[model samples]
Target: MNEVGVIDWGIVGAGHIAHRFAQGLAHVRDARLARVWSRRTESVAAFVQRHGGEGCGSFDDLLASDIDAVYIATLNDSHAGYARAALAAGKHVLCEKPATLNAGELRAVLETARVSRRLFMEAMKPPFFPLYRTLCEHLRRDPIGPVGLVRAGCSVANVPAEHPSFSLDTGGGALLDIGVYEMFLAVDWLGAPLDVQTFGRIGASGVDTFASVHSRHEAGIAQLFCGLDLDGKGDALLAGPHGYVWIHEKWWNPVRATVSYAGGRVVELNVPFEGGGLNYETAHFCELIRAGELESPIMTHEKSLRMISMLDAARSALGLVFPGE
Candidate 1:
């Protein structure tokens, strides 16, 4: 940040999520894409050409360059490594969800961020979306009582075989890739996961193709499911003693919600998003960087740890361990 207080960002992995990050970056004030790097040279070149960033020759170049932060948008397997390297290099890091392969791995990366004394936040975008924020405010003002249960799920069966979600080596599966979102909702509304029970099937690719998770949190219980071989509905529910909140289908990219109370009173919330849904999280990260915050108050490190821990337990129950685990 120079006199004008602008932040430059270097990105790892010019993949699908990275493209969304770049698109969202356009909506973040005073943040610019400084450098882009990925495994494939051609992908790097193409991404840079489309997204208005200089293509870096290698990851070392991207880190060594004079950038204020790093966004780890790589696959699940590499999120921890890139986040650790970025924080160790004295850059604030905003890594994609799951943060790492498992709770143990996330702990190591978080320790690195702590020693580095830099901001590190998992890119959990739902809380920042307008609809979600509105829901929080409404709950605070009107009261939803103590939320005691959370239920959510998302699954798609048409994913191509070549997609990384089916690849066991890259740490792809419905749990880490999709279930993490549901877990985040549970942890946010309920609390730290105390116990997790799961039932699932591992596909021929040696990865979990579908999973159903039932978890006990400090404050409540959660029922979540994720799959790459089923097309289940993708809505979410939060039940309380006095009422309930319903985040409509595709809740992860939430736009609408309804609150129903014990008195038969009802309220509907609809808040649209722009510049893609990822911008909200990107903007929040930028604000945290400026404020010298190490952990996000909303997307706290504790919440991330709890979410991934639930996934770890679920994976363990399913006997779906990635290589080198």
Candidate 2:
């Protein structure tokens, strides 16, 4: 942090998602973009010009800068390595979702955070949204009786073959890329699953282009569908014995939701925001650093481990294995 109390942030990637994240930083008053590093010099230069940051010649240069934390927006397979490096450099780490390729890699990163005594978090944005918090409060009050089923899906049209998300070596798949959002909502709301089943359509690249998962929780069941080869309705529903909650289109980053009782009583909510939804997570990360916290209570390490474990189980059931896994 500088003398003005602004936490300097170094970005580790210059991809599309990284651009979204940089845009999000504009809404966080306590944080400032400090440096950016990417293999592509032109990409990094453009990112800095738009986001008010300097372009580092290399990842090492970014780590050596006067930054309080590093926001890693790298490809799926590179998440663990960059996170470990940033932590070792004594900078807090905020890595994007699917924090690691598997539970084993996640464990290694967690161990590094412990040894380094630095804050580490998986940048799962949905859980940090105000709408999600409100829904959680309603669920706590049992406004929907006991939730018995959760149905959620997130899908998008396929990208070009050259995109990293389409390559198995880069940890590309519908599950790890988009499906984790659905999985997070289910696990966070329903707890760990006792039984898991999955089926997937593998593309020529040995990645799951489409996948469906069923997880049996103690109190209910969660049904999830995700794909990269097609488009979906992008919605989610939580139905209980006496009522249900409906998250509007693009449920993962929704701005609205509705709750209805069996008797026909209904209530709707609108969650307004500035910039992209990524701001919520960015602000929360800065808050944690200001408080000298090593982990986020909302997105705890155990929660990340559990999420990845479920992903691993589902992938195994579908016979979807990444390269060198």
lDDT top scorer = 1
Residue 111, model 1: Cα distance from true site in angstroms: 0.8
Q: Provide backbone clash counts, one per model.
A: 0, 0
Worst 10-residue lDDT window, candidate 1? 1-10
Clashing pairs for predicted structure model 2, backbone only: none
How many clashes show up in model 2? 0
List model 1 lDDT by residue over 1-325, tens digit each: 7536789999999889999999999998899998999989999999989998799998999998999999999989999988999999999999998799999999999999999999999999999999999999999999889999999999998999999999899999999999999999999999999989999999999999999999998999999999999999999999999999999988999999999998999999999999998989988998988998999999999999999899989999999999999
Deviation (Å) of 24 in candidate 1: 0.6
Q: What is the model-wide C-alpha lDDT for candidate 1?
A: 0.93
RMSD of 1: 0.8
TM-score to native of every candidate shown: 0.99, 0.96
Residue pairs in clash, model 1: none
- The global C-alpha lDDT for each of the candidates, from Candidate 1 onward, is 0.93, 0.89
Query: Cα deviation of 167 in candidate 2 (Å)?
Result: 0.7
